[model samples]
Target: MAEGLFGVHAAALEVRSQRMGVLASNIANASTPNFKARDIDFTTALNAVESQPGGVGADLGGAVKYRVPTNPSMDGNTVELSTEQTAFAENAVQYQSTLAFLNGRIGQITRALKGE
Candidate 1:
């Protein structure tokens, strides 16, 4: 019932949350030598989730890939602080948006159930 009510927003939130973690990790390892910055292909992951039977608990690991640096660092670290920070900020916004959508949906359901 909850799944039907929320549809893909729940899965989208999960993907956005995971993406935030990946981006944050990249930022944290920006100075670590040879640390390959990784990120998920959000659209692909969300599509994978929607295609699955339950559209939940979908494995997103396959969507994660190492980012190719625009300019290779001398130390071989692929993480660029500026890029990572931007991605992190963007993903955070997306996560918050998804959360808000879910909250609104829940409120609607609650009101309906209350006969209001």
Candidate 2:
């Protein structure tokens, strides 16, 4: 489990961070003349990451399919700004937590290396 996490945790964190950024952008542009709301299918992205050898992070060139709107806005706006912003905030918190754990793991490794 530790090995898997050590390899994949970073990938999960990165994907989540990417999702947060996209969601935040969507929210920020919500009032920008009919922007349509965008969302990341986190489940799909996670699955995609898990399926790849060493996880998707191993292949930075690999493309993950986004949850694009099947029904786009008439004004070419797809961002539902409020929803995106809320999601962004939530994801950011999660990202921070994940980072904390990853950092903690690194700290533990450092201590172990020092024979602490």
lDDT of 1 at 103: 93
Give the TM-score of each candidate.
0.91, 0.71
Cα lDDT tens digits, model 1, 19-100, are: 8888988988888998999999998899877777776677887899999999989999999898989889888888888899
Compose the digit string of candidate 2's lDDT tens values, residues 1-116: 55454766777786787787667677677657655555666767766667666564533323433335555666777665555666778898888988898999999889999999
Q: For each candidate, what is the lDDT? A: 0.87, 0.68
Give, for candidate 2, the lowest lDDT window spanning 10 residues: 58-67
Error of 2 at 2 (Å): 9.2
| Best model number under lDDT | 1
Among all windows of 10 consecutive residues in model 1, the one with the lowest summed lDDT is 49-58
Alpha carbon lDDT at 36, candidate 1? 95
- Which model scores highest in TM-score? 1
Clashing pairs in 1: none
